[model samples]
Target: MYAYDTITEAVSDLKKRGYTKDFNIRENRLACDQLDTHFGHEDFEIIEVYRFEGPSDPADEAIVYAIEAPSGALGILVNGYGMYADENNSEFLQQLHERVRLKS
Candidate 1:
């Protein structure tokens, strides 16, 4: 899990890495354009873009993404959710790494 000071920072980092702003409609939903120009790009098929939601705590809620690798492995996670200091950051990167390192 990447610790970001704010959601914008995370979004910016992804955008810089070739992720484009694809869509935004729902209050908590944001869709990013595909990273691949053609089929079978990175073995990791980027899926839906989502923002986290909770009943009471907005901070607890985080933005999430769904990713699927070419090998049929599935994981729904990203690099922007967790605690800033140390004790709260979720292992989102670990989840992402699991999918990213798949054998395409």
Candidate 2:
């Protein structure tokens, strides 16, 4: 695995490499704002992941996941970790995190 100094840098470079869509965490699925699409855990696959820390603040901790959907759509999911994380869909989030962490 490689390292990225910052999420912005990773995002810019990933976009250049074809991770163009942005996936947001929804209650029970991932949503691509640009494509207006929703995907459940079974509907997509993780291609890459880039984790980042605040250096001093835990609030800055986040993970960028390169994702691919069944329709051949590619995207990125940016999720924060630790305290202050959204838990309304904790189960789905945990599964996604575990899958990538374990696979990667």
Candidate 3:
């Protein structure tokens, strides 16, 4: 898991990579919202954003987002992630990977 100095930096990196605030906010809210949700306000403590090579499917070749909810210590997975390589997805990811801390 990667760590960000600030959530804003993470969000900015995502935005630069063609992700919008609406998308992130929506995903976060959906994953962490709702009183009885698995990732409610009492689960985990970290919200992580990263990318993986994905499986053999086209849809599978996407970025993956994982959030540590604040409720049940659950690790919520948000799939179907995308980014604009022309922008700075790689750079951002590299920087984040190099700069941000990680959970053991």
TM agreement with the true structure for every prediction: 0.31, 0.90, 0.31
Q: In model 1, what lDDT does residue 71 have?
A: 45
Tens digits of lDDT, candidate 1, 22-87? 322122222223422212233356564555444565455565454554544434434334442122
Superposed model 3: Cα runs more than 4 Å off: 1-28, 32-35, 38-44, 47-50, 54-57, 83-104
Return the clash pairs for model 3, or none.
Answer: 42-70, 42-71, 43-70, 43-71, 43-72, 43-73, 44-69, 44-70
Poorly placed runs, candidate 2 (over 4 Å): none
lDDT of 3 by residue, 28-93 (tens): 233333334433222344355555443454444334344444333333333343443323234433
For model 1, give the RMSD to the true fold: 11.1
- How does model 1 fare in lDDT? 0.43
lDDT of 2 by residue, 6-79 (tens): 99988988888888988998877988878888988768989889888897899889988998988888888888
Native-vs-model 3 lDDT? 0.40
lDDT of 2 at 94: 83
